[model samples]
Structures are given as C-alpha cells and as structure tokens.
Target chain A: MRRQVMDWLEERTGLETAVNHFLYEDIPASAGWHQVMGSVALFCFMIQILTGLLLAFNYAPTPGEAHSSVRYIMTEVTGGKLIRGLHHWGASMMIVVVVSHMVQVFLWGAHKKPREATWLVGIVLLLLTLGFGLTGYLLPWDNRAYWGTVVTTQIAAKSPGLGAQIERLLGSENGVGVVTFARFYTMHVMLLPLLTTLIVGVHIYLVRRHGIAPAPNDTAPKKKFFPGQVFKDTVAIFIAFCVLFALSVFLQAPLGRLADPTDTTYVPRPEWYFLFLFQTLKFFEGPLEVVGAHILPGLAIGALAMAPFIDRGQLRKVTQRTTAWGIALLAGAAWAGLTIAAMRSTPPETDMHAGLVDAPEWQSLSPEELAGLGHFRKQNCHACHVLGEKGKAIGPDLTASATKRDAAWHIAHFKSPAEVVPGSSMPPLTLPERQLNALAAFMLQLKPGSGASLDSAPDAVVNGAMVYQQQQCGICHQANGFGMKVGPALNGLASRRKRDWVVKHFYEPQMMVPGSTMPPYRLPKQQLQDLTTYLMELPARAPSRD
Target chain B: MLAEDSETSRRRFHLGVIYTLMGTIGAALGIPAAGYLLVPGSSNRKEEWVEVTNLEKLKAGEPEEIVFRRNRKDGWKILSEKTSAWVTKKPDGQVIAFAPSCTHLGCAFHYDEKHKNFLCPCHTSTFDLEGKPLEGPAPRALDRYQMKIEGGKILLGAVVKSQES
Candidate 1:
C-alpha cells in the first residue's frame, strides 16, 4: 500500500524517472552498504528537527525556567525523553557523518578541480552542523552543556578587537543567562539549522549535478542517478537509520545532569569529535593559547572556504590530490594528538586518593565510594596510604598497584583493608558487588604521577591548573593544598584513575558522584582530563597547590 | 574596400555608444545601492509634530501599542509585533508619547519604577519621567509622539524609531 501511494505521488510529480530511472537503476545495492553511518546521521538530523520542535513547545528560554522546563519535558511531557535522546545522539551522529563524508570526499579527490565548490559547501555544512550542536548544547540547561558553552564562547573573546563584542553578541555580556539562552536557542533551533539545511542542500545539489566520480575503469559507461544510484543511496540511508534507531532506543543518549553556573567544581568536556580542538588549545602560552584555540581555527575555516578560489590546480585523481589529502588528515591528526596529549597531561595532583580531599566534600568519588573515601579520610588516609610518602601518612599509597595487588588482592583488600596491612584505617568495604568494584577502581590507582600533563607545555599545565584552582576543582577533584572536600584527591590520579574513567567523569561527574556536591563539568574532554591529570599529580606536596 | 571600411566604422560607433550608456547607467544606479547595502543608512530624524496614533485603545497617561509595516531596505517588511511598544501619553488632550527604546542607542528599555526611570544596562543609560535624557552618553531624549484619540481602538498610524527630544 505504501509503495503504491509513493509510486502515485512519484508519478504525479513526474519524479518516477528522476527517482527510479535517473538515480538508482544500475548501481549494485550491496556495494553502497557501508554508507549507513551517513544515512543514519542524516536521519538523526531529521529526527532532531522533529523532536526539537516538540521540545520547543515546552522549553522556556528564560534563565529561571530553562533548566526546570527541560526537566518538565524529560519527566512530564510525552516522548520528551526520546526527543532529548534524539537531539543529543543526533548531534553526536551528525559529527560522525560529517567526518565520514569529509573522508570520502578527500579519499576520492572530490575536493579537487571543479568540485572545490562542493568541498567548500560540505565544509560549511560541517561547521554549521557543529555550530548548531554547540549553540543548542546550552539549550538543555544542564551543567556540562551550559558551562561547556561558557568556556567555548570565552574563546570568542580572544579575537583581540572584536573578541569581547562577538562574545557579547553570542552571549549576554554578563554570562550565559536568559538572553544568552534565548540567543543560543534561536541559533541552535532556528538560525543554525536553517543555515546548515541550506548549505547541506547546496552540498547535495552540487554532488548530484556532478555525480560520484567513477573509479579508474575502462569499459563501463557512467551510471544514471535513478534506480542505479539512489537505490544504493536509499539502501545506504535505510541501514543508517536502523543504526540511529538502535542507538536512540537501545542506548539512550547521555543527559547527565543540570548545570550550575556558581558551582565550579565539575570539569566540562565536549563530545569525542571536539576532543582534538580541545587538545590543540593546550600547546601554547597566553596569547599563543588564544591563537591555537580560536584564531588558527577560524583561519583554517576561512582557508577552507576560500579553497575553490585559491588552489588553481587541475588535479582530479586521489593520488594527484595527495597534498590536500595530507592537509586534511594532518589537521585531524594534529587535533587528535593534541587531544590525547591534553587528556594525558595532569598537573600536580591527579591522585585519586589523597588527604587533599578534606571534610565532607567528596567530588569525583561516588556515593558508596565516598563512604569508603570518607572512611579513609576521617582517619587521614593520605598520612597513612603513602605511595613513597605522597598519599596518606600511615599506609602504603598505591603504585604499580595493578601489578602489586592484582585484581584478587585489591578486591580482598577492599573487603578487608587492614588485611592489606595491620594498622590500615581503611575499613572493610562492604557494598554490593558493582559499587565495590567502582570503589576498588578508585582505590587501586593511588599515586602522585602526572596524568596527561606530562605531555603538555608547562604554561598550559599551569593555566589548566589555574582554571582548576579558580573553579576550585579541588572542591571535588582535589589537589594537594588547594581544593574542596567533595571529590577525592587528584594526586596520583595518573597511576590510579584510568584515562577513560577520568574523561567520563569530566563529561559528567555525577555519573561518578551521585548526590554529588560537585557540579558536572562542561569543559571539553581534553581540557577536563588535562586538568584532571594535573590534579592527579598533586601530592600533598605539589608546589602549585601550596 | 570602401563598403568594408564603412561597416567596420559603424560597428565601432555602436560599441562605443553601448559602452557609454552602460557606464552611465551603472554610475547612476550602483553608488546609492552600494551605500544602502554596506553603510548604515542615516538614522537621523528630527522631532516634528508627527502623528502618534489615533486609536481608541490608547488612553491618556497610559502606554499603548501601535504597529505597522516598516519600509526597510528591500521593501515594507513586517516588523516584530513585540517591537510595537508602550508609550505614555501626557496630560494634555494632544497626547505626548515616548518611545520605549532607551535613549543610549535603541535597545528596548525596561521600565524600572523603583528607579523611576527607564534603564539601559548595556551602558547604564537612563531617562526621566517623560523620556528626557537623564544620564549616560545618549545624544538626545527618547522620541515622543503627537497622538490623538480616534474610534474605540488605539490605531498607531504613523511612528518613527529615533532619538528626537
């Protein structure tokens, strides 16, 4: 019945030939199978548009109600959870699609010669897609989203003369509040989507006009677009939608917690795609930091935009387009490296277990885990849990713990801490099996080694540490002398905390800390873990904390 | 030979004439278009006895709403309805209307009765009871209107956004 109706509409529109004969008649259906990710990405965007509209029905952009209104959508409105899930995952999938699309374009040298316009349009669409994600991110009014936006927009202020003005234009001069929320909301839902949609249309139109480049073959004629090309495209689209539907349904997107503007304890990080840029920002000093973070990025974009006009070359083959290909990969790789380095670089106290965690504020430490940390801290865990005199005073601080204690000893020690040592204040951790593991993970890696900070510039290390200090990262993820009582100490975080765990915590601390006094961080993952690693190195003796 | 020479001369003359006409037309049309597109059009408007509005909904001493299409660059465009703002009338029957736009540039001023003046927090520009410039670097007072009542509803027939005292 659906096919008949669709066929009727196609006939009425005279699109039967266009859809069936011109686009999809001859291409092998199976060969286009792997373009599913792109199809899923595009469908996810459509889903975002639909669900976003539904969310807009209930979402109030005013500062006071923004957070609560989103809560209402999530908990009260019909299918609000699904809508939010679609929006969040749609954003993630869009990034994935854009990356995949760019790779395809590059590997095929589609960016060369007459197709530079197509490449340029694709670049713009990618950027607008990311921009849409960035601006809309703050709309949810969650901790990571809000503060992450705040941190990202501050880079706009690095443009020297126009920086502050652009920042004010993007956000209200004061901060991300009612005006900012409304503005970001408009850009996200209206302006950005419109711009992206228009550009995406242009990208598609150009691609269709100049059909897919034929591989180096001798005899076969170019395939028409109808059933030949679009069948493949449609099949690709269907596979992609299935993956998106699976993601949206089976694994609901991560909406960790609401943002607190005043609570600076949590570190915010962007999605994985943004990790490279976040990492790239860590390589410079003060002004250089600005260039690396914001200026060069803008220039790179401007260059990409101007590519059609600049690279007056006649190359079409992928081999001939090697220079451009290298540049594209280099750009991606550079960012990835910086991000990895940034994630690995921790300042002084990346130690997860230290006396640096004072009082009742247990930050990154989970609730049941907090009970364990509290037990350890109440007895001055740092003084005793000494890893070469860096942790507690009375006991052995964890080092080579994975090797030394191994999984069995670690589990046994947590179940009976004094069993590890006679005078250990670490009491027996008696929780359900899962939480016991989380706490055990927290406990097993207590050392004062630097996290990712070892790979970063000293100044960047200092700046990240400074941000940590100003935000009072220690309030939760504590360093040595400076920090609050929420999250556990960062000293020895490198040796103890897995990089993935630290990054995840940075993405949403509450996932680690329920009933967490520590706010979820909205900083990019690279920045989050950079600061995390810095804190990991703080040994009750690190100089920065002092 | 003579016929060929004459034809060539005629072709050259036609080309010169077309080029001259094209050049002249472009000169006449292009300058103002470029200016309008690129430059901020002169925002100057003097305080004249402009019609505030003749509408029944408008009441004396109370602010009323008025809206109409504005002739912006392209053509008459539909302005946002919210841009139709509140303007307080004066004591006399000839109503004295004040633009809700703040005196320090044209941002919508929130009426702060507590402070007894309109405030623009962008640079802390303030205006007095009748939209007189009270503080800040505003060049002049908020624009006022010469209003009259007509029918049962307030009809804002004509209004201009400006900083005329």
Candidate 2:
C-alpha cells in the first residue's frame, strides 16, 4: 500500500530510473508485493481514527458511568454498534498492521545505510502506535480492558527511577483505585489520539523525505510510482478492506463482564501483539529488571534514532546491512516471546498461613466469614462441602485450602458467594446477630458445628426472608410466582416437610436438588435453628387482601 | 530562456512563500480572536431585590409559602411573576428561606415521630433537625437559601454552589 502511495508521489522519480540505477540499486524482482501490503495497512488505520472519533462523542470515561454509558451506546445510539465495532476492530487492526509493517521492515533489512534514519524513525513510530493502541485498549471500560491496563501499569513500574514515580503520575497515588479506569479512559479517547495524529504527521514526513527502501535484489530499470504502482496499490487496499470487513462482520470482539474494580480474578493482559514485551518484563525482576524493562528498550530506540549517523558505510543495498537487521530481529523476538509467555503463565500457588490472603478467591470474605467449621456445621456447610462423600460440604474441605486463595480474598468471596464460588453446594449465609462476634471469632476454630447459640429466639419471618434472597432461592423458586421458573415454587414447602427433616434439609438444600445452583452457606447454629424453625412453623403470612 | 525563465520562477516562488507565511500567521491568531468575540462586551448591571412573601402573613416556627419574582436586564429580562419557597420567620424579624428538597439523595425528608429524625426510606440515611447526616452516608446538610426581608415579604438571593464540607 505504501509503495502504491509512494509510487503516486514519486511518479517523476522513475523518469531517471531507466537512466541510472542510482535511486534503487537493489529494487527486488518482487518489490510489488511490499507496496501492496503498506497500502492495505494505511486504510485500516484511517478507519480506526474515523470510527474512534465518532464513538468518542457518546462514550463516558468515569468509573461509575463507564459501564452504563457503554450500555447506552449499545442500546441507544442509532447504528452505534457500527461506530463502536469499527473503533474496536480498528484498534485491533492497528496492532496487526503496525506489526506487519515492522516485520516487513525487519525481514527486508530496510534499516540499513541510507535508510538507517528511516528505520530508526519507523521504530519510534511503532512504539508510539503501540502506546496509542494500548491507551485506547481501555476506553470501553469492560472488566478485561480496565484490569488489563491496571496490571500492565504495575509491570511498567518495574522500569526503575521513573517507574514508580510515573505510576503515581498516572494518578495511582491520587487514589486512582477505582478512578484509574476513568482516567485512562479519557486519555485513550481525548489525549493519546491527539498526540498520535501530530506525531503521525512527523513519521509520515520523514518517510516522504527518505523514501521507501527498495527490495533486496534488483540490478535493472526502476519502475515509476504513478499510474503503474498506484494501480497496484489501490487493488491491494481493496483486498485488505475486504478482509477487514469480513473480520468485522464474522468475528465480533467479545465484550467481557462490565468494568468491575471489585473483580480481582481479572488477570490483566494486553492484546496479543504486545505479549512479547509484556512477558519479557517478568524476567527483569531484580536489578537487571530495569535493564530488560526500560533501559534495553530505550537503548534500542536510541540506536534507532542514531542509525543515520552510525553507519558511515558506503553501501546502499539493505541486503548488505547485516548488523542493524540482526539487532532489530533480536529486539522484536524478545518482546514477542516475553508477552506470549506472560499470557500463558499463572501466578504461583499461595499459603493460607502466609497472611497474604490476597488470593483471588479469599478476597471476598470479611473477617467474620463462617468459613470456620463451627459456623459451617451450623449453616449445614459440609452437607455440600463433603460433596460425593454425601451430605453438603458447605465450606469445601479446608484441606490444602489456602493454595487456591488469599485472606483478603475471603471478603470478596462472601459478598454473594454465588458470584465468586458459583457451583459449590454451600448455601449463602445471611446471619442476624446470633452471637455474631463469637461466631466470627470462634466458629471457624470449632469443628464444623460445636452448637453455637444465637442472640435470641429466631424471628422465623425474618429468617425466612433471609433464606429467600440469600440462597437466591428467590432467583429461582418463586414462592408464589415471583422468582425465576428454573426451580419449583417454595410457597408451600414449609407445609410439606416434617420438623426434624425440615431442620436437616435446611442443613443442605442441595441434597434434594441434584444440580442445585445454591452454594454452601455456613449459617450459625441459632440462625440455622431460626430458619428451620421459622420455615417449618410458617402459616404463610396470612394471605393479606391488601 | 536561461536567465529570464529562472528569474520569473524564483519571483513566483518568493511570492508563494510570502503568501503561505501570512496565511499561517492568520490561522494562529484566529483561535484567540474567536474566543474574544464569544464573551459578553460589558459589566453586569446591578440587580434589584424581589418580594418573596408577606412578612405579617408568616408565623413563628411555622414555615409559610412565599411567592415572588425578580426583574433583571441581562439574560432572562422579563419579570418573573411568582415562584414558591419555604420561609421561617423569627420573632426579631429575621426570615429564612429554604428549598424543600433533601440534601442526601434529593428526596424530600419528612419528620419521623418515632425516630425523632428526618427519615429517608431509601437506605435509611437519617438526618438531624438541621438536616445533617444523623445516621446514613449523607455527605452534607440540606441547603439553606440566602435571603432578607424587604417591605413586607422575604427576598431570596441567587442560588449558588454549596461547599458541603
């Protein structure tokens, strides 16, 4: 594509091409293909820019507003998806084409001699382009994009000197905690695009001045860009657009869960093209870390900028520039490999005793979680945790438990455990004062159930209410037709089950329903008694006519 | 053909260069010029206090409805005939005007006898007699309007941004 463009611009250059081989001593026999590819990539980027701007007018960047705003675009904007979809695919294509451009440059040894300045400037353009792509990566504010950027910035802090400082400058210290999504969102839409366009002008200017490097082996008459290469370029671009359209229509980008700051399990990772650099930073863990993370990349760029000056060599053919090409190949491979490995890698297992309960699963629980066996037994926790061994093991066997999670993790897990620990047989616990402090402190320490007491007699009605929303029994079992139809109505369940059996059944509802959606709820002994006693004794709230 | 053609081309190129430079300068100055034109040409004229409620009609402690209007020269020049607001009269002749909207979530907070506080059913963020957060997550107190008594009725000042802290 670029060749087609250059062909049009330098149509007159070939006037003397047949006279002397001075312009391109090594224009390849198949130099035509390279021009075709560049033309394709240029059009893709323009699509991204245009779509991104249109989408910007409707997008909101704040943490609270991000998700709702996106919903509005999807449901409200007339053909908003076309605009958003293009912006999305455009970003993806930007990474794709930029990479393809780099590869073409690298494989051909276009970074040599007279083209050395061009090669260096092109490298800067690549980095700037990637930076633009990454900043835009978070604008949709989906859980994946938001967390992915957060995780990337943390890795960026490994850059030494300015790493931590820059992280703060990016607004982390200002308590970006939940707000960083909004901050990155604004930069992605408003700031980075503006900077990208300005720098793009410079990148293109330098390209025009130095001109494209010809392919590796030509000792004949050079071709004219206009009318000849231009036609070829247009044909190539048409093909590329056809491919882009196919991709946009056939493979829509998945919109992951909404931007959930509370979601710790969201493993942050950038788009695939960035995987190599992202992964490589992992090895820079200690003192040499700065070298791998920042210094090396910087030195590589510095070398690029200094290329025009370094090789005072008398050669014009990039085919002869072995050393520069070698360096470029190594840098590209390093980043690509590192990011790939990072994507494949998983964090090492943690210990429950380690005090670093930052484990993904554990973050959901508060200090008062009924994960303690005593609370669990009262809540009939093991009726499900014990799993195939029969009964409920409300709290899964604590054996090797800490390996999967951290302490703080327990906080997030407990909120609506169904959200965190979905299929486990444990019912969700909804406690009411029942020796609350004692249970929080001692229940976990006691065996599954040591018969914990309550603050008072069970208010069966309130306990029944708890059972409804907590078990999300309300979600499925419509007591009289309000809940999801997935489960049978619980309206008359209290009238059906016997007292002792009802008590035991309440211990673990899953025992009856083979594939129940309910999780292990470690209710305290009193609350358990309260709920069972309440449900068993209910006269159905006296059908009020009002 | 040598000297004459070269001389003409050079002159044309110089003139082109001059025109481009002048055009660039004009564009650079265009932004500020546009901004200047958008602003109001002069200072704001003094505003007159409008009558809100009858002084004798309002009783002590009991909030009375005050309705009035204001005339201004600038934006919204037509005299507004009437608007309603709550006014409290003091024995010494001080009148306080306040909006009925609650500060917390913007729902009107009614006095609850049992709780002895202004209760909000939404999340139960209770407020004190002065409409401050007594129980819930309200960041600020209810807004009180700036006002004064003139002739026989209370006059309300312009609404301004509140510094909740």
lDDT by residue (A1-546, candidate 1, tens digit) is 988988898879977667554445343222343333444456557766866776676677765567666655554444555556666676787787777877765655556667877887778777788887778777767666777788877877676779888977887578777778888878887798788778767876776676554543423654434333334445555545556556766764544345666654556776567767777776777758877876878898887777666666554556767877788789778767776776665333232222112221223323233233333344344454432213422333243233346556777777886877777766676655644554454454332232111112233343355356445454554454344556565565776777678767766777876666666678865667656555554443322210
Candidate 2, which CAPRI tier?
incorrect
Best by lDDT: 1
Candidate 2 C-alpha lDDT tens digits along A1-546? 988876775686774555333323333344666656555566666776666655565666666556555555543455554455656666777677776776666556555666665566566667767777777766666666677777767756655667778777566654344556656766766676677677667665665566666654455566544434444655565555556656655654455555556645446666777666666666677667777667877886776566656655554455566775687678667666676577668453221112211122211222133223234446664444431133322343332142245544544454457777777544456764432332343323322111222112233534544443455554555443344667665544666766676566556768855677656556777666655654454332121111
- Cand. 1 Cα-lDDT: 0.57
How well does candidate 2 score on lDDT at residue B102? 59
Interface C-alpha root-mean-square deviation, candidates in order: 28.1, 22.7
Worst 10 residues of 1 chain A by lDDT: A448-457
Compared with the true structure, what per-residue lDDT tens digits does model 1 show for residues B1-165?
Answer: 999998678656645654554454345334533442354422222221212344444566554545432222211111213334556655574454565566566787766767867777777888775667788877787775444443322323345455455
Evaluating just chain A, the predictions reach TM-scores of 0.57, 0.56
Model no. 1, DockQ = 0.01
Model 2, stretches more than 4 Å misplaced?
A: A1-31, A156-158, A177-186, A215-222, A286-288, A303-336, A346-546, B1-165
